[model samples]
Target: MDEDLMRALREDRGVKATALAKALGLSRVGIYEAVKRGEIQATRIGRRIVIPAHVARRLLGIEMEAA
Candidate 1:
């Protein structure tokens, strides 16, 4: 993972699908595909879909802090 993306994930509470797709160099449809395949987890907040920071970190192989 790049430093900028790591920093963004670390600082943000959650990431939107578009931002996540950009970070991963994927299209929005790719993100949707991942969600369908259960490769990434997402939650819908009204019309917006949000991916938790911890989940993104895990997908990037970043160690998460113990809760």
Candidate 2:
């Protein structure tokens, strides 16, 4: 993996589901549905759904800690 990607992954605290879906060219509803079906990793912050950075790291096979 690229060092810049690794660095960015480590620095990400949380990624909005909508933004993630948009970035991946997926539907927001599909993203939410995937979350509901446990196909994707996510967490709820009171009422907001957030895709945690750790999930992204794990998916990309880039385990890292923020400097």
1-67 per-residue lDDT for model 1 (tens digits):
5565566677857777777787778998999888878888998889787788888777656775543
Q: Give the clash count for each candidate.
A: 0, 0
lDDT, candidates in the order shown: 0.76, 0.72
> Clashing residue pairs, candidate 1?
none
lDDT of 2: 0.72
Q: How much does candidate 2 score in TM-score?
A: 0.66
**lDDT for position 19 in model 1:** 75
lDDT of 2 by residue, 1-67 (tens): 4444445466777767776666567898988998999988999998888888777656555567546
